[model samples]
Target: MSSAPVETVLVAGATGGTGRAVMRLAQSRVDTLRVLTRSSDAAADLRAAGADEVIVADLLNPEGLSAAVEGVDAVLSAVGTAPTAIPSGPPFVDGAGNRALVAAAADAGVDAFVMESAVGVGPEPSSPLATAFDAFIGPLQEAKAAAEAAIRDAPLRHTILRPGVLTNGSRTDLVTVADPGAKLWGVISRADVARLMLAAPTTPAAHNRTFEVVSKPRFPARNVSIDWTLP
Candidate 1:
């Protein structure tokens, strides 16, 4: 028999592009889908899109977020800047908002977390190709780096996907990223990224895994399975 499904999930930043995809995917598979949106109208859209519960809360408001996350099995975050958007504000959203959410999740007793970061951020990114990120993508890279630090170091069990260049495309469910061979870089579909993020907690290999993901394998119809052995 199949294991019991994760009944309820509270998705933060559900109105955004990748978040919307994750929400829809979760709703289709999980028993209940709950979303947190700043705008009532956007919450309505999420509900119309089949969200079972829409909680209106600002990411900046910890109490409000704590209230929203209550009684959920897990939390999935796809929060990020828009394609045409680069935030130039103080009290950075990616860093501060993620920290707040971590606390809120703890308070709400939601342990499993699936979050997104980028492919390169560490002091020495291990891969030579990642060197290019230092100058061009500092803002987002730094913010995501800080948020990832919070997630990795937090008390909760987390799986953070540091995806390569994201594009809206077909989700082949064939993406790969790990140590040694995978430390290099490439691109992945946003849809596939969402699918992997939503599927993280369900896979035992995914627990406490902070890996990068890229394009599909060259071989098709073989049923790709990524080995999570640390290099």
Candidate 2:
């Protein structure tokens, strides 16, 4: 399938780590960087951080998302819940919120969807490290797995990136991307993930693909090379 360049992109969870990195980095790359946030107060700062427009909406409630995704070429979701929030209850953002977003994006005619998922959230024989990580996070990984399934079933073209441990380290641009079942285990910076998410929509190789991403110089799995430049 052919993928077209994104002139306007809507970023969900623009206040989170990877989302912030995307907001900071996407300023010069895209014609318009739109952000969706739950807080109306975040609008000014998001604008200052290079967001051309800010739509205040919560993903858990799907009603307002049609407006949130309207007129955007692509949707990039970095939404996730912290481990501490696991005990609180259902309606976990990782699964429910993202599923809602996927539906809304498809409804609004968004061309592509990019999701930041965690490793071990898809398929069988998950690596030991990923298994342990999932166990530590309780139901979060399961929620992400469901979200991944929702994306796959949706009509829109999608790219799901399952990153190992995420850190606040710098963007090295040396990332190792592989199929989900690869023996991939390591950490990657939020900045690097942001770079790839922004690039995925326009990169034909990344369309309708799911990848496991990790920082380079670690892990023995064969890496998948993708042209990360925005067209």
Per-residue error at 83 for model 1, in Å?
7.2
lDDT of each: 0.72, 0.89
Tell me the lDDT of model 2 at 160.
Answer: 97
Once superposed on the true structure, which residue ranges of model 1 sit more than 4 Å away at CA?
1-5, 83-87, 124-129, 216-231
**Backbone clashes in model 1, listed as residue pairs:** none
Task: State which candidate has the highest lDDT.
Answer: 2
| lDDT tens per residue, model 1, 1-231 | 112246788887787767877876777677888998878878667889889999988776666887777887778988775423454553555667777888888777786787877777655344554556545666767777788888877777788887777888877767665642255466788888888878777766777767767774322322236542211
The total of clashing pairs for model 1 equals: 0
Indicate the TM-score of model 1. Answer: 0.85
Model 2 accuracy (lDDT, Cα): 0.89
Compare the candidates by TM-score and give the number of the best one.
Answer: 2
User: Tens digits of per-residue lDDT for model 2 on 1-231?
Assistant: 677779999999999999999888888988988999989999998898889999988888777898889998999999989888888977898999999999999988899999999988876567777888878985998899899999999998999999989999999998899987886888999999999999899888998999988895465447887787663
How large an RMSD does model 2 have?
1.3
For model 1, what is the alpha-carbon lDDT of residue 62?
A: 62
